[model samples]
Target chain A: MKALVHEEKTGTKGLSYREIAELEPNAGEVRVKLKTAGLNHRDIYTLQRHKPTDPPLIIGSDGAGVIDAVGDGVSDIQVGDEVLINPGLGWKEKSDAPPQGFEILGLPFHGTFAEHVVIPAENVVQKPQYLTWEEAGVLSLAALTAYRALFTRGQVQSGMKVLIPGIGSGVATFLLQFAKASGATVYVTSRSEEKCRKAVELGADKAIDSNGDWHEALGGEKMDLVIESVGAATFNKSLDQLRLGGTMVTFGASAGDVVQLNIRNFFYGQFNLLGSTMGSTEEHREMVQFIEKHQIRPIMDHMYPLSQFEQAFERMEKAAQLGKIGFHIR
Target chain B: MKALVHEEKTGTKGLSYREIAELEPNAGEVRVKLKTAGLNHRDIYTLQRHKPTDPPLIIGSDGAGVIDAVGDGVSDIQVGDEVLINPGLGWKEKSDAPPQGFEILGLPFHGTFAEHVVIPAENVVQKPQYLTWEEAGVLSLAALTAYRALFTRGQVQSGMKVLIPGIGSGVATFLLQFAKASGATVYVTSRSEEKCRKAVELGADKAIDSNGDWHEALGGEKMDLVIESVGAATFNKSLDQLRLGGTMVTFGASAGDVVQLNIRNFFYGQFNLLGSTMGSTEEHREMVQFIEKHQIRPIMDHMYPLSQFEQAFERMEKAAQLGKIGFHIR
Candidate 1:
């Protein structure tokens, strides 16, 4: 099987396309003949920071495929079933912590940037029928993150005001859609005017320039919830824009993590800063159902064949893509 | 009326004992002849930072007194009634934000540090009969902050592992009592061993040295909730000690507010950092009832006459007191 394998945990330069030994389903697992795979910033972090002591790794956390085989005692799912991988392994239900042995796909274990991947049978949910193969491939990681941050943590409601900062990423796009579909007044910010306009076109109530004064741009409309993945550069500003007692759910910190915060203002304003990651399996299923229910579709930027891995990496490195960048795997 | 006033916004040195104009009750307000007044860090902040534009400002937020007079339309409270001033004015009910014109007492308006303090009638709750005047005077601000942090934001539960960092402050002392009364396994940390020992004597399950390695001391017992008031120095360490999805409520930052945080760890752990301040009137009422129900006594460290306020402030500045410092007012 062909896979995009990193020989060393360096940077994109360490990535190479080569033939690797085909994987097989272990007990209670299923072999997925992946049709498509998606890129995420986590993959970039794993490449740049994972220790060299770590084993050679395949990178990718999201994918859609058909199951080729099922291992012993795998009774719920059958071979050839269309499914979406729940990327987050071992967190089967809602819990305060992910279960021991929990690892997202594509780090310690082989991931979807390969022709075939074996995952726990339980990690695969029947893919939402309304989504295309490309859409399903890119939806899980970003959609689940947005779902948990908005619904599970932020508790976003129909009339609540929501703000999504740095709105060009796959997760931010999905957040904009999910919040809009839920009847929230969605406000978005992006460094790129093009992305802001795109967000407004996709039902965002307002789109503001990230480089501008957000407080001035929003014009006194404070957010009840802020989905903040952009760190240091925008974190304090995000804090400033929340209504008293409002929540900011932070899942990623792409720019940097060193944030300057006035503890006095935070407490006096009564803010909640919640940290979130991937969702539980239950939330993953609900995310798929929610997208289906709202007819939500992943905003595709571009797709490349598995062979053009460097091109995909280059596009993401420049952040030139508006939405998800994918690889046609099969 | 005699009052402890800060004639300028220049730290504790600016505070002076002086005779000020006697205050009169306004429409829908009452004038209380303060019997005892408690010192809070917030009072210090006001003295140190609030503009001199509000000069001759009386300084103190927590007090118990006999209502000396009531203005017209003041129906719920009457003259000569004993009460504890809520301190947080204009926020009469639960709100995501304080009502317009919301302000803590002792800032722009004359506050409890004076011989007579005038406040809105709704801001006074009848003092609990079980409490000593000293206890009632010191209980409102700190107890309300702790109540909102633990029960309102932290959502603490019976048998949950709770950690209170920097455990010698008025609020930390009340938090320890409140959590213990609610059947929680309360753990405490303080730079001073004597304070830790005092916490244990007051029913804390364990007390650790804040300067020591807390993770090793706890022996793998992760905290479900952390009451964090010590800032910059302990914020990152507090994040490290919380169990996944745990909540940390921060209401003060005596150490400083600038702190280094690893964003990856925060989001991956799915922790919550909630910022709280003095609570609403409803919560203040609830706090008073809770104390009465539990028969919890406010920990009194020392007391001085109103003229010795500078010495009291010195004791607090040195962090020498284990609990609350109060002034015996007339």
Candidate 2:
């Protein structure tokens, strides 16, 4: 099986497109003939700094394919069923905290960056019928993250006002759609005016120029919830725009990590700051149902053959893409 | 009527004991002849810096007394009824956010420091028959803040592990009792060994020294919830002790307001940081009921006559007390 493997120690130069052995399903697992896979910043991080001396690794958390075989004890799913694989491991149910040893598929375990991958059988969910191969492959990670942050944690409801900052990421796009579909008025902030305009063309009610006076752009309307992924650059501003006792849910810190907090403003206004990551297996199933029901077509920026994995990585590094960048695996 | 007032603009010495015009109940109001009043840090803030030019404000928020008069339309509360005042003004119901104009009783409004106080009839709830006047007087503000932070915002439940840092404030003492009564294992931290010993004697599972090796003292036990009122001084350590996906509910920042947040740690660990002030009127009522059902007695440090207001203020400002300080106002 052909795989896009990061082989060197330095940078993007480490990526090597070559053949790798296909894995067979273990007990309670299934083999997937991956049709498409998504590229993410996590993949880039591994390629740049993860040394070759580390255990053999395959990188890619989002993928869509057909189940080629099922292991012993897998009774529900069958061979040749079209499916999307949830990358989260060890967290199969909703819990107040992730179970110990919880991890995302990709690094330590062989992932969908290859032509064929074997994952736990329970990770496979029937792909949303309305999505294309590329959309289904890229939707799991970002959509699940957005779903949990917006609905599960933020408890967004109809008539609530929601804000998503750094609107060009895949998760941010999904948040805009999810909030609007759930009947919330959505606002977005992006450094690129073109991206801002594009978001409004989608279901967002308004888009603000991130470099400009975005706070004033809201015209004094307070947000009921904020989906924050852009960390230091926008955290305080995002919090400032929330109405009293409103919530801000975060999943990423792309720009920087250390942020100064105004504790008095936080307590006096009774604000809630919640942190979220991907989601539970139940949420993944519900997310697929939601996307299919709403007919949400995940925004994809570009797709390349498995051989052009380096090109896709370069595009993501430059952040030149507006949405999920991907790979055609089969 | 005799009242304790902050007469000047500088420090605790500005507080004076004087005679003032007796209050008469307005429409929909009742006048209470105060028997006991609880002193808080907010009173110190007013005495230390609040300008004398502001309305003739009497400083105290927690009080229990006998209703002496009822104004027009005040049918529920009648003369000679024993009651405790819910000191939050303008917030009459549970809301996602406090309505505009919400204020505590002690700033622009004349408060419970006087021998007589006229407040809206709706603000009075029957005092629990099991409590002494001193306990009921001091319980309202601290218990309300702690109840909301623990049960309402933190979503605490039986069998959870709870941590309260910088113990010995009125709020901290209440949080310890509330968490313990709710079937949580409560741990506390304080710089003073005597205070820590006092907390363990009051049903806390364990007490750790705030300035010592407190983290090591926990011996790898992670907190499911943290009630954070000490703020900047212990914020980072408080967060470090929380389990992944645990919540930290903060009500006050007594040490300082400016704290550094490690955004990566927050999002990666999926932590929840929530801010809560005083609870709603509905929560106040519920808290009173819960206290009565549990037969909880609020911990009091010392009581001074109304004429000894300066000494009480000095004790609080110097951080010398372990629990609520108060005025015996009869």
What's the lDDT for all of these models?
0.88, 0.87
Stretches of candidate 2 off by over 4 Å are A8-10, B8-10
Residues A51-138 of candidate 1: C-alpha lDDT, one tens digit per residue:
6667777888889999999999999999889998889988888766577788899887889999998999888989888889999998
Question: Tens digits of per-residue lDDT for model 1 on B1-330?
Answer: 788888765887778888889978879999999999999988877876667665567788889999989998988887789998889987777665576788888887778998989888988889889899999888888998899888888888999999998998999999999999999999999999899889999999999999999999889899999999988888878878898888889888999977766776889889888888878888888888899999999999998999988889889988888889998995
Q: For all the predictions, what are the DockQ values?
A: 0.74, 0.79
Which stretch of 10 consecutive residues in model 2 chain B shows the poorest summed lDDT?
B6-15
Q: List the lowest-lDDT window of 10 residues for candidate 2 chain A.
A: A6-15
Off by over 4 Å in 1: A49-56, B8-14, B50-55
Clash list (residue pairs), candidate 2: none
Best by DockQ: 2
Give the proportion of true interface contacts each model preserves, from 0 to 1.
0.85, 0.85
| Candidate 2, residue A136: lDDT | 88
Cα RMSD to native, each candidate? 2.0, 1.7
